[model samples]
Target: MRQRLTPVPADLTGTVVTPGDRRYAGLRSTYTTRGTPEAVLLPRTTAEVAAALGYAREQGRPVAVRSGGHGLSGSSTNDGGLVIDLSALNRVEVLDRATRLVRVEAGARWAQVAAALAPYGLAISSGDHGNVGVGGLATGGGVGWLVRSYGLTVDHVRAVKVVLADGTVVRADADREPELFWAVRGAGAGVGIVVAFEIEATEVRNVGVAQIAVAARPDGSTLRRWAEVLRESPRELSTAAMLLPYGSSTVLSITAVVAAESLRRVRPLVAPLREIGDLLDDRVDLVPYPALVPTAHLHPNVGQQPNLTTNGLLAGMDGGDAAAIMRAARGRHRALVQLRSVGGAVNDVPPEETAYPHRHQETLVVASVFPPHGPGALDAAWRGLADRVDGAYVNFESRADARTFGRAYPGPTGERVAAAWRRYDPDGLFRAPGRLPDLTASRG
Candidate 1:
């Protein structure tokens, strides 16, 4: 039987929530709100985490960890297990401005971090939105506009403070626990809970950002242009063009962002598309990085939707392949497709090093159903469509099996990662959608 602490620990400083707790429902729900846990433990300090883990280990109870609650796969949330909620550990210290490095608590959200760092004229290469937690996103192989110039967020991670499964606390950095550090940089959360992250900050200020909407070209001409432009364009700019369906007509919503002072400087580069033919609603302008994340979630009322796409170096989108790929997604099923350019600093690192595999692929063609996720669903359509996908981005990942995760990383890195995970989490306490193989066992 599980050890029941009816009255809770008197010495415990942080909040301990049970089924009767008023905040239990709110604490249990994530952004996706799919997974549910038995009880929630909000530990204010790393010491509290260690204590809780020690208790669970003694009781032989399973435990899961959560930071941002933005996990798409419900990996952090649980149905009937103990959860170490680190959402309270939101502390960011500007350790060294000269070194351009910042230490952020695992619970720190990018939104707060960005605003906090803006005053110092320094920021980390974070994902698109400020709401996403720095730890969860980085561990899953972060890919944002900054990715084009600086590489994944993991690449910038200098060190991490984590509590292992067996109540052991350790620090992983380039100098300490080098192998564990490498594994944590990309797959840290897989083995344990990270309380804090030490990452190199980028000196970023205001820049030119654009959101252009256009009439979708069904014949594949629009895709061809996007592929050619992104492949040949200079590394200074990063662009992602999306094709969404509205009624019978398709709308191409393109977001072209760059680190330039004014949009005019890059107008000539995008002029080719304007010359190609007619488009609708081109609202390309400069805006703050924080404003880019439109506050919204895709509608999920309907059944499962169709989403088929790919991500690779721009070279992978050959003329014929690009045309066929785009054409496959343009239909009544409403598979919104996006072609993302990858070159800049993202290509600086080889795929073999990190769990994030696609370092060289130039463009990521992602397509999925429009609204809702069910019976008579669009799952089959998307499954069949995306079956041809050559790459799997852990960040964009839905619920994929082990084989699907194998393709998440490059060559031998996948097996090596499995090995690391199995060693730490021998029993796979947190089993969910995005869980990889027993990394430790694989390594063994």
Candidate 2:
């Protein structure tokens, strides 16, 4: 019976990608540059998605949902399983201006939504770059430029429509399925495939942004200084620091952003960085966030390879930790070290209240570098390089880990979210790496 689905549906009004098709290969390949899927189902509507899931469930076929295909994990593909391409459902709608709310399809990009909301003087709290999908980003503990002030991408989410393992299509929000809603915020991809999202938009206009890069300091003194600065900076301003090395020199990239309210008056705050080092270039200007993305695109590209990253929260690390990282990065691939200044609104909400942890941590440090394919010795080099760091980022973990997923969230949030996942998916159908497992016991 499942063989009938092999042919492209003529009446479905959406594209169906099957094996042996030219487009099938590209559609099935994940952005991680890893594995490919067996078959692809592109559904244009929520009902179509439900139907696809119904078909898969009846056939007892394992299924994986593909959003951005940008996830670092292999969640979007299977060796021989059904794959749902949700990018077909990508849509964004302005619900009401007075209410400051919008409905976005699961496949919509942060750039698309921000562009859609610019005319209304409103925007959702989104991540740094514009290319990332809102669905996966929000579900994986979204930490964005606006997070320090407004909160996470999930914090603004009002509701989500999901297709569960049993082919159940349900809408969950703050007031409806509150338990599932809480879990959906952090565990949506694991619990089910989210089709749409309702989010609260923030009022923002001309904002101040600064992109500064300087010659490598003797130590991370300047980088650490930036971290301290971000901690006390007004909530209106957000900052992130990156250490990049080229040849014998390393550059400290400090990016500072001020919310619209302080757009015109942030020079006093940004001027301190100029004195921190031998300045290379500083571009500080006032512009709408929608306009800032052009500058955001200038940095490293996550698509070049399968990214392996180690990320965690730190209270306060002296210069010694920086030295250890530098020593660990002695080879060809210079590790791009990142330390996010996390605080403000992120701390006001209790960690257990949501699936996202790392709220109380004063700062977050991430070590990111992609896999290199070369001489046989390179594999050992990469493995030995990662040994210098501890643990992995949920967003960047090679794949989901059932045993340690609970540890990703702070407090008892992981266990609480696991219970909600059971109530929703019940079967281990939607499970992915770096996320909780499906509620198989409940389904049994």
Candidate 3:
């Protein structure tokens, strides 16, 4: 028998979904974890979201906040708790065409945002996947296809409308509620539920994309060469490479994105990458920016892609560092390894500028192990490259422990992030259990 749900506030009557409701099945889980939340509140407006928060607080149950529900950590849903589902609030509007400013609701997916901005020839550098929610990625960090040229999605966020833990609605920007605005850009999950963001989009209508595959040397020479090429290349070029098992060896499959409109400019930018290794396959196409993150990738999250994921950032990749990464990818556990270029425009931001302070890192290394294998296997695989990593990206991590907090928010950045989280959410209302470290304790 289903447990009885507490009576919801009158303001949230139609917005509340219980286990008995038909929609509960779809609302109870995320992409990486299954949940059994007692109630899922679907707020359609800022007022409704405030009401939903009040209603959930009265029940004295753990509250999980969700935007697109594609978070790798699966903190958006919980067992027998209350979940604030923001999907219904999705809206993308061009606030100012002259300045390329866009007002995007938190619930809006990257795909929807791309589709909405296509006509204006403006685009925000969001994550590679279109299904990823704007709230989570923008709040945390948005390393996207155009990252080298446009920078992270959070970097473009000019302002944000958030619903605080105490049911207070406030809009934060550099000039207004400045501290809250700083935390919202990178450490938002611990502070509040961000409903919308006013971002300054870039003028980009089309780009040149290339897919290249090459046989990698077991000694990591090929990986080192790939990094060298990227370091010397122009900011317009950004690439993501995956190391896959091929026959008795490994293959480095690379997707290079160039922020250039014509093939002539794109060809020259990506030419050096082909010389890195023995190229097996190569193709380049000049396509619209929206095509890179199309609506075709939209899908519901129902605990579909369960896996263990972790990541680390590297300042530079030497031959030894490259060897360690290759060993991890070909280890006994054999975790799937992916590398993304991250320097260029990302480094243009000063370390003290925002919550995401690791601006000097040149590469992002992510490793994932699907089920049948678990955390132990994932950890074992990551051991080789552990000491070489400079920092970690919060969005790619599955475990939200103290160590991760320290890495994601290092030194002064961590201290400021913790203080901001405590100031905005003194009662620890938005800090999901085990999802974030206790802000009161010294982050090790």
In the order shown, the candidates' Cα RMSDs to the true structure are 3.8, 4.1, 1.5
TM-score of every prediction relative to native: 0.87, 0.86, 0.98
Instruction: Give the total clashing residue pairs for model 2.
Output: 5
User: What lDDT does each candidate get?
Assistant: 0.65, 0.68, 0.91
Candidate 2 residue lDDT tens string, 1-444: 334444433444455677778777567756665454556788888888887776666645568787766676657766567778777777888898899989999877777777888889888767777766777887776777766788778877888898887777888887877877787776667778889998888898667788888776546576566666676577777777787775677777888777755644777667777667789989888878687543344322223456655565655545755554444343455655676666788778776666775566666666556655332323333354333333223664553655336446434666676666776766666764323454345332
Per residue, candidate 3 scores C-alpha lDDT tens digits across 1-444 of 545567886777799888899999899999999999988999999999999988888888889999999888899999988999999999999999999999999999999999999999999989888999998999998999999988888898999999998989999999999999999888889889999999999999999999999999999999999999999999999999999999879999999999999999999999899999999999999999988889999988889999999999999999889999999999988899999999999999988878999899999999999989999999999998889999999999998878888889988999899999888888888876766777655531
**By lDDT, is 1 or 3 better?**
3
How well does candidate 2 match the true structure in TM-score terms? 0.86
123-216 in candidate 1: lDDT tens per residue?
A: 6766776667766887777767655766778878888888877768999887887767777766666777778888898877655666667675
Return the lDDT, model 1, position 333.
56
- The true-versus-predicted C-alpha distance at residue 143 of model 1, in Å, is 1.0
- Sorted on lDDT, best first, the list reads 3, 2, 1
Error of 3 at 154 (Å): 0.9
